[model samples]
Each structure stands twice: as structure tokens, then as C-alpha cells.
Target: MSTNKDTMPTALLLGATGAVGKALLKDVLQNGKYAQVVTIGRREATVDEGIPQDKLVQKVVDFENLNAHREAFRGVNDVFCCLGTTRADAGSAENFKRIDQGYVLESAKIIAEENPAPEGEQLSPVHFLYCSSANANKNALFLYPQSKGETEEGIRQTGFQRVSIFRPGFLEIETARSKPRWAEGLALSIFPPVNRFFNLHMSVPVTDVAKAMLTVAQKKENAAKGEEETTLTGSKAAVFSAKIIDELAARPLTQSSDEVLVVRNPYPEPRSFKVKTTAPKQYCVRPNAGRIEPNSKVEVHVILQPFKEEPPADFKCKDKFLVQTAIIKPEYESLSISEMWARVESEEKESIRQQKIKCVFQVPPEQIHHETKSEQSTLDNNNVVVNDVLSETPTATPVPVPLSPVPQRQQQQPAKQDLNDQLVRELNHAQDKITQLQKQLLVKNEQLERDENGFRARSQANGPSRKLPPTVQPQDAVHHHLAALETQRVTEGYPPQVVLIVAALVFVVTYLFF
Candidate 1:
């Protein structure tokens, strides 16, 4: 896509106090392309010395109540978000999630919905640029990356016209902070050297990240302007790796002349290439022609001549460098550089491959402080108007909106009430989950208590048996013998007594018979 050079857009910046955020603020102010730079934060940002404050409109608001500060977000064309916090800094995972995930997402929603276009202008697509971490995945086991991923996912769903997520690797923060981060410092000390030596895109300076973001936004804006030369590659929801960020942020340095270009051969056949530039007077290409073995790469040095006068601010050099490559053929194998190119141009045109890289100039950081008196006055007046509305009270809270699996913004009919209703429904759903968990816990506790009681009852019932020795009998088992006396009386005393009884009985029987 091509970008318009004439459009000067307003930009809304969040988290200006952070390392990358601070760098972004600096770059945005110095670029001089943004018509206005609105900053929203909890406290006043500590602007650096020499940074122009004219374009800056800082608002101190309650981030917790972002609704109250909706005006701060109005009329912005781009959003640069660097709002994030560590679990340790936030004091807990929940707090981290609230700040990293909740705040980031809610802010996106507020800006996307509440922010309206300037009067008399149609609402243009709002480009969202987020600073996310490398390896950020919603399904990640760790909280930090997971939260970042979730935040990125959520912001995409907020209906922004374009969503660019920058996943920078280990950041080397140069800005001063209240507390030092030992982990980052350690990594910065150990990883960068290895990263460079191996050409691993595992570490990047925070400033580079800021510049990369600006580059992307600039490219997108330029595309909007219909600049035929601008070729903004990537998806609507683009993900930039550290390497891509560095590449996009490439700019000529005033102090350095040497830059490296890497040419690689992906095919199994040997390849020959020649490098040429439109700015031959300003740049020198070393070993202008080279051959690369199959599956190998060669680094070419591009030396820039010192500028007699510094280029104008926001200057984009029209000069370009082109690399032409072709497979090595035996027919032109021994030909001189010019002859080989001539032969290839005439015969092997179909096999010739070309790539072009345009030259970009870095805007001086001090440009912000060097504005003309009248321009400075105009910016100051604008800042005054913007400052008049700054307040300490927080206003907007994210009214719940339906989240779609696809990257589509849900319709916000009657915006306010629908958001509130959706949020209430989500809250109710969460409450139901909590209630179900509580009931299950209660059931488990009751079952545990019943099991305990049954165990105790069984223990008590078998207590005596458990206490008795296995070999011992009870006292009821003892027996006694008492047969002797009864037997003697019946056998001896029965002679007289029994005979008298028998005779009496016989006489009675005879009398009765007669």
C-alpha cells in the first residue's frame, strides 16, 4: 500500500512512562508528522529535556475510570499502546492480568468505540500498534507471555482498522527507572553479543522497537496517501518479529557509513549476484559482484559518503540499491562482470532475479526543539487548548461487548446500554461458575465428614476386641461340678422312704380296685 505524504494525523499514545513508551513518545514528537500527540496516563509523564512539548498534550486521568477521560482519545488516527506490567510489579497474577490484559484490552475498546472522528471528517480506520512480547501465546504455560498474547488477541477483536503486534525479543532498556530490573539487565549483558554473532534476532533495543512501530505507522499512513512508491507488506493483523522490526527500522546513521547486506542462496545450485545503487556518488558497494555456494550466504558492505549537509527532517532519499542474481551457467562462466551482465540481460533475462531496497533517513531527535518561533507558538496554543480538558477524574469503564472468534468488532447499538448489559451477562456467568465450584466444595466436605463419623463408630464397636489378647478367654467360660450329694441321697435314703411310699401306694391302689 502507498502512503500519503500530505496527511498529518493525530496520534493517541498510552504508557508514555515505560521504556519503549518513552522512546515512542520521543520519536512521535520529533517526527513532526503527527498533528497532535495525545498522552493518557495515571500521572504526568516525565518528558525529557530538549523534547518539544508543543505537540504533546498530556492528560492525567484515573486509568481505572478511563470512561471519564474519553475526550482524551477523540480524533486520534493511530494508537500506540505499550501498557504492560510484570506479575511482580503488579503484586499478583490477577493484578498483572488486570493491568496487562484487562487494561490494555479495555483501552482498545474505549478508543475504538468512544473515539469519534473530527467534525466534518469521516471516521477513518484506526490503526492499533501494540508492543507485545516474543513467544506470546494464549496457550502458553507462563502467565506473562500468556497475558500478552491474550491482550493482543483481544485488541484485534476491538475492531481496529489495522492491528500490528510487535513481539520484540529481550529488550535492552536504556531509559532510567525507579527500580532496576536485574533479569533484563543480566540478559542484556549476556545475550546481545551472542545474538549478534549468531545473527539471532533474540534481542533488540527498546528504542529500535519504538522506531519500528513508527516506521510501520508511517508506512501505513503513506499507503493511505496513495504514494505509488510505498509497498507496505504484511497482513491487516501483522506480527513483526525482532528481525523484521530491525529491518523495517533501518535508517542511515550520521556517524556511521558502513551497513551490511546479506545475500543468500536458497537453492542447491550456485548463484552469482551483482549489487548496484542509484546513488553511486553517495554510496560505495564493496566487492560489487560475488558468487555464493549453494545453501550459503555472502555479506556485502554498503558504505555511505558523509553528507555535505544534513538532509531535511523526515527526508526520504529516492536513491535505491538493487541486487540482481542468476544461476551460474557454463556458457557465461568466464565472462567479465559487464560482459556477463550484458549476456544475461540479452539472453538469460528470464533467469534474472532482482530485489530493490530504498534508502530511508532518520529524523533528527532535536528537530522538535528547533521549530520556528511562530510554529512553536502555534503548538503551544494547541497544547493549552488540549490541556484545558485534562483532569484527575477517571470516567470510562469497558462496557462488555461480545467477543467474536473472528477478528470482527461486535455491533454496539445504543453503545452505552448494550455494553453495560453484555458486561452484566458476563459477570453473571462468572458468578454462576463461582457458585458451582462452591457447591461442589461443600458436597466434598459433607462426604468427608460422613466418612469420618462412620470410621469412628466402627472403631468404637471393635474397641474391646482390639484391646483383648488373642490367647485369653472370658470369665463366663469357667464350669463347676455338683453331682455328688443328690446321687447319694437318692440311692441310700430312698430304701426306707421309697419302700414305705410304694407300700402305701399299693394298698391305696388295691382298695380302689376292690
Candidate 2:
């Protein structure tokens, strides 16, 4: 933990605002190896993690519109992606996928691609460590699992040169975070045994999970290794493969002298993490103590690694480790309209930030259209339409002219009226530009499609052309389409070339691993 700052590997923490991520931030920042630490979070935490205020990079992003943000990922060395949202919080399964699945994959893809080797003197590629769910599967029966699985698969396929996926279980809620829609405490008590028979699954403490992930990522090389290790790591990996998990659901560690057992939560208690460090010098710790709101309960239990080579039958604390997972729930089940308004308002801020690049390129184009398009504004007043049009305008052009100035004496009313008129003009000009760009994009796409049709017709006529790889045509189209989009976005100002390059890189990296 006392490593020098110069020795630290730069890590980008994507979900640093979360309880687990917050833990990682503390450990990573305090350890002193932190050459640099950057975070992309939904909202600003009231209390800053120890990282310098400037070091903490926050982005208000609509998990849904991740595609528009690939550029913002530039220069990130390693990415710690722990971004997630539940269906209840999101209001529907579809919304959950948009955040959990879509945001996760899109963020991974960009991180894999855009991360440049940290530069200054030395050169090293970026690392990617993701916090995935235990039951993640693209084709699972449940919505959450299915999205998580798909997200995992997508990340694996994306070419992040170095990627590590951490799948912690439901958790041993030991933090004090509040959630609006978590299962009621009574319901959790009534829930039946899960992961009991399953050799691979287990709930874990959030703090331990965070610490372990930080430990692995701090190694630097974890991301560089080409092979994908699809399991929990650090202390968790050790506990998942330990014997004590079966001996005691809540207690898993035994001291060297065999005198004491370390359990997370003692009997007859909920929302608390207890440590019974009896004999043999076992450590008594509430790992999640440094991480979350105090009200959260930790319910993690595990059946660890299968018995291997003949050694001691006794549970050994020295050989095993695990973490404390936190569960953050709000105070209510359903969001009131006002709450929804707040949620939407909060969600919109992120939507705007991500849309900045979108508008920069997507709107600037004459084809996207400056007029006759949707004059959309969010409830938060994000002028989606005008921004799009104005964004696309080539910087070469000055803004549309303003109206006559307000005269003195009638200053108050006239100035107000004048300001309103000027805004109208700006909005009009933006709309027109957007329309022009939209039309151009439409025409370009159509032309490309027609060219493909022509090529197909020719291939059909020649027969031999069909021998060319089917992948070739599509690949060409994709390349062409993507290139055009890139160029168009640049011209319109939706995406910078840096962003597109990063996106492509993510795809390549993920593809290699998958």
C-alpha cells in the first residue's frame, strides 16, 4: 500500500461512484502507486474519494447512448467498468438492458479501443477490468442474466488487449447505501437457498470484491495477458475455491492454530457484518466498512474450491480470502411521478454530455438537416434539436445573425424580448443545418446501398464473383459506412476521429478475446 506514485499504474474507474467502485478507488488511490486515476461516473458523490478533485473525472452519461461517447475515452490506461442499473430502478427490463447491457458493452468496447498506452516516458497498452454479475449469460432465461451474459460476450469479443471480468454474487450487504427498489428485507429473509448446489456461484462482500479487483488490476499485467479468466479473483477467487465455505455458510476462514473461525454475519442479524475471529489469529474485519451507506446488509455465502492435493483438512485462513459485497437500495418500491421526474432529470444530464460528441458531428453535417427536424428538448431543457443543427455547422461559419438591439428606457422589456428573438433565430438556423445534414446522410447511405445492389447484380451475372467471400462485401459496406459516419461526424462535429478510432479498436480487442 505504500508504493510510490511513480510506480503506480494509471487506472480508469468507470463506475467509481458505486459502493464497490468507491472501495476500489480508496484502495487504489491510497496505495500510492497511483500515477493517475480517472473515473467516469453518473453523478458526483457528496464526499470525494481521496483522489484529487481534478483526478476524479465524472461524466453524466445516458447508459443508453454509449455509442456517442467512444471518443471521450481517449488516453485511458486501464478501465474499471462497474456501471450497472436494475430493472426496478430503471422501471422496466428494457431500461435495465439499456443501462446494464448496453452501457457495459459499449463502454467496454470503447475502452478496449480508445485507450492509448499511457504516455510521457514509458509506453503501455490499456487494461480493462469489468464487474460482471455471477449469472451473466447472453441467452439466460432471466432478463438481468441474459443482458449480463450478452454484455460479457460482447466484451470478450471486443478487442480490449487486456480484460478481466469479476463476477461477484448477490452480495453480503454490509454497506450503508440506500436503494429505492431493492427486495424488502423480509423477502430476502424468505428467499430459498441459491448457489448451494451450484459449485460456481456465491454471494460475496462488496468490499472484498472491490479490493480483489483493485489488487489484480494494480498488477498491470492482468490486463495484458491474452487469456481470459472468467471467474472471481483476488480474495474472492480464493474463497470460491476454499473448503470452509461449506463448513460454515457465513464463516469461511480458520486461523493457523485452528482455534478461531471468521464469519461475515453472526446469527439473528440482518444488515450487519459480524466477524468472529476465534483462535489462531484470524483477522476481524468489516471489509465493507470503508465502502457504503451503513444500512445495507451483506448476505454473501460461498462453497469454495474443490478439495485438492492431500494437505491439512483444517480450514486455513492463510490460504483463503474473500470480500464484502454491498447492496444499495432506495427507500421505496415504485418511483413517484416527482421521483421519476428527478430520475429523468438526473438521467438527462448524462444524456446531454454523451450527446455533446453526437451533436458535434451528427448535427454539423448539412445532410443531417438544419430545419424541419425534431425540435426536441428534454424535461431538463436539453435542446436536442437546436444543438444537433448548430453542432453540425462547420466551425468555418459564424453563428446565424442576431436581432436588433434593445433600446434604452425600454431596456428591461426590450432586452428580454431581444434575447428571446435571438434565441429563436439561433434555433431556426440550427434546425436548417440539421435538416441539410440529415438529407446528406440519407442520400449517402442510399447511394452506398444502391452501389451494393449494383455490385450484387454484377456478381449474380458473373457467377464467378459469387466466389468472392460473402464477408468481403459486408465488410466493405461496414467499413464504408463506418468511415462515412466517421467523416460525416467529424464534419458535422458529432464524433471526433479519436472517438471513432477508439470504438473500432474496442471491437477488434473484444473480438480477439471472445
Candidate 3:
């Protein structure tokens, strides 16, 4: 499953409106890696923040009718099932099970069966990622944990090529609560400082769970690209514990940079690099041209001098200037690259910092239209006239009119005559063909009757004295013979009656016209 680098992946999201689900949706959109994000929920879904509408498709569907929307699962690369519910929210244990276990399992089953791997691929095309509780156990006495464990089993049994189950502890959501829980609030307040010291797998942030899921998906995708192995520590599915989840979430947004400057080599091989920039005219790169060894580091110094031109009143130069860098390879042309962002700011004194650019935004130009008016002056009969008189007076120049080659009447008369003549010829030809077919049919019918009668007479005369070979009865033979005659006549052309009627119509038309 080596995928094209330019091809963006598509993801299907369940429980998009939930806390972790919302965070996951934002990360998927903001990462700009997914080409399409399909969110399915019982009601219409909306993003809390703005995102690319082209990449997001919201499908409002009834969970009870999952089968009806089975086609939606086709061609999906990753399924993020964040659907969950509490017994209180669902009003009963049965309802909670229906949401947590039933819906999740059914969706996974459909996705596994519908989304098949590409031709010649061994693994299932879709990867299943489920969010389960840390305490989830199939034999657990509690219904909630039991339901979550059942869902985990159900997803694994669906036979997805790769499955990543996240068993996160209690999630801390910053948004307004739909239902207040005193125990969750007390834990959130007390667990942050002491949880790390005691190694307690208590509460975790909603965002960390979302980030962990994305990290797993990206890892699997990279594995498919042959950048890494599919198996993680001898297991196909990587189940992240609470501590692992926190570490992943706490990871730096980008590669660490030096206090003053930073440089990164995304390519596999070491290459010579140079830095260039436009505007401000104060930034300078020391030893701009240098070779960066493979899997190594390079430190460069950037000096910022005083600006020559005064800054605009509203200008914010924090992240304004474009820093262009290029890589020089032997026997190959130099290529410009902008994989990192550099910002020079005056904080008490001038300073420069660089970090990898995660996302790029391009603002389109605004559209506006301007209207123009033209005025013309005309002189009529030695008196000047403005726009008003120009409309009343005729122009001196004559306008030419197109003329037809023939008059309308004459053109139509010849066309009508030609049509009538063509019709007459067709009618005559048809009548002749029909008459010939009818005569042939009658001859064949007569011959068939005579043969039948002779055969019957012979059978009667022979009686029991001579035994004759088995043959069709006289009535059946006559019926078959007549059927053959009718088929031949129809295959030849129009029937006799049809030809006669057409001929009579043509005669009447000609008589009336002439």
C-alpha cells in the first residue's frame, strides 16, 4: 500500500460532535493531510471552528438504519470511532449498550466488509481506530466497561488490516459540560499534580487522546509508504496506555530549534544549503552555504540590523518576511525550499527564532467591479443635438440587409415537389416488394397443403399393411407452414395491408395537390 505522496488520505469520523471527536476533527482539518473528512452522526453536525468546507462532508443519518448508508464506508482509508455514551445520558443500560457497543460494532463491520484493499494488496484497505476506556474488560461487572470491551472485541473480529485501540483514562474537556459530574470535577482538580508522582492512570485531556489517534494513523500510513515496519513491538495493533497517551500529547509541535536559529534536513541525504530573504534588508546568514550531514545537525547564526525603512502604522512584522532557502546537489539544479518559518522580533532587543511551518494560509484577492459611462454628440441638420435628439433622428449611413438566394414561396414549392416525388417512389417500391412476397407466400402455403393431404391419404391407404416413419400430424404441419410464411413476409419488409394503405395515402395526396 505504498501511496502517492501528493494523494491526501480520507477519514471517516463518528461522534464528531463529542469532545475528543471535535478535537480529532480539528486536527485532521488543520493538518491538511486528509482530502476528505466524512462525519456521521444522528443529527446534522457543525464544526466549532472554521475549516475547509471542500474537505469536510457531514452525513446526518439515523444510527438505527446503518445498513442503508453502507455505501458511505467504501474507499475510506481510516475510521475514527469516538462514539460513546453514559447510562444516565442514554436513560438506561440497554440504550447505552446500543450506542457504545451496537453502533460502533455495526459501523466497523460495514467498513471492514465494504472497503477492500487495492488490487494485489494483502491487508484490508481501511484501518480501524477505536477509543475505549482504560478499565474496559469483557468480564467486567459494570455495563459501561463491559460494553466498551465488547466493542473492542467486535472491531478486532471485523478483520481490519490494521487496528489501533486507545484505552484512555477519564478525559478532561474544557468546554461547557452537558451534564455535571461531581466525581469527575473532584478528580480533575486533584489529579493533575499528584497523578504523575504516583503514576496514577486517572484523568487525561481530551486533546491528548485525539492527538494519539492521529499519531497512530500517521504511523500506519508511513508504514504503508515503506518508511517503517507495520508491526510495532511484534504486534499489528498498538494499544496506547494512559502514560503513553500523555507522552504523545506532550510531544513538541515541531523539531526543536536552537535558541537563536534552527535548521532541518527533511531529505535522507546530506546536501549543501543556503538561506535567502526579501525585505527589511537587515537579516544576514553567516556561512550561508554549508553541507549538512545525514541524520546530523547544523547551527547557523542570523544577525538582524536596524531597519532602513520605517514600518507601516499597522504592519506586524512578527511573521511577515519570507525566508527562502535552497538545496544544492551535485549534477542537479538547485531547488528552492521553505519548510521552516523564521521570525525576527524586537523584544527589548532584536531577536530571531525559527520553527517548522505546520500550515500555510493564502488569502485570495477581493473582487470588485467599476462602472463607466460614455457620452457622444451628434449634429442634425446644422443644429447640435445631444443624447435626446440622437434617438429621434435617423443616421446618414445606410444599414445593409441580408437577402436570401431564392424567394420563400419558390424555395418551399420545389422542396414540397421533391418530397412528394420521393414519397411516391418509396410507395411504389414498397407495393411491388409486398406483392412479390404475398405471391411467394401463397405458393408456399399451397405446396404445404398439398404435401399434408398426400401424406394423410398415404397413411389411410397403407392402414396396418405398411408402417410409416413418425411424422408431424397434418394440422400441426399446416400451422407450422403458415407460421413460416408469415415470418418470411414480415422479414422481407412491410406487410401487404400496410403497403396498400401507404400507397392509397400517397395517391390521395398527389391528387389533392395537383
Error of 1 at 55 (Å): 1.1
Better of 2 and 3 by lDDT: 3
What is the TM-score of each predicted model, taking all chains together? 0.45, 0.41, 0.43
Per-residue accuracy of model 1 over 1-514 as CA lDDT, tens digit each: 6556447798889999888898899999999888789988887677779988897899998878888888777778889998988887999999999988888888888887776444564442687888888767776899998988788668756765566677777777786568887887788788777754543446777777787677667645223321111111111111122111012112223334565545444345666778778888878878788776765566667677776444445555577666566666777678776787788889857445444445555333344446442111000000000001100000011112232222111233366478899999999999999999999999988976675455445545666333323332354131101112112343645578889999999999999997
Name the best candidate (by TM-score). Answer: 1
Q: Could you give candidate 3's per-residue lDDT for residues 48-132 as a string of tens digits? A: 5566667788888889999999877777887888999888889998898998899998888788778765678655767778888
How high is the lDDT of residue 432 in model 3?
Answer: 100
Candidate 1 stretches with Cα past 4 Å from truth are 1-7, 116-124, 221-514
- In candidate 3, list every pair of residues with a backbone clash: none
Q: What are the lDDT scores of the predictions, listed in order?
A: 0.61, 0.47, 0.55
Q: In model 2, which regions exceed 4 Å deviation?
A: 1-7, 48-55, 62-71, 116-124, 180-201, 221-224, 233-238, 241-514
Model 1's alpha-carbon lDDT is: 0.61
**400-473: candidate 2 lDDT, tens digit per residue:** 22223223324456766899999999999999999999999999999978866765665566664344334445
**Model 1 alpha-carbon miss at residue 18, Å:** 0.2
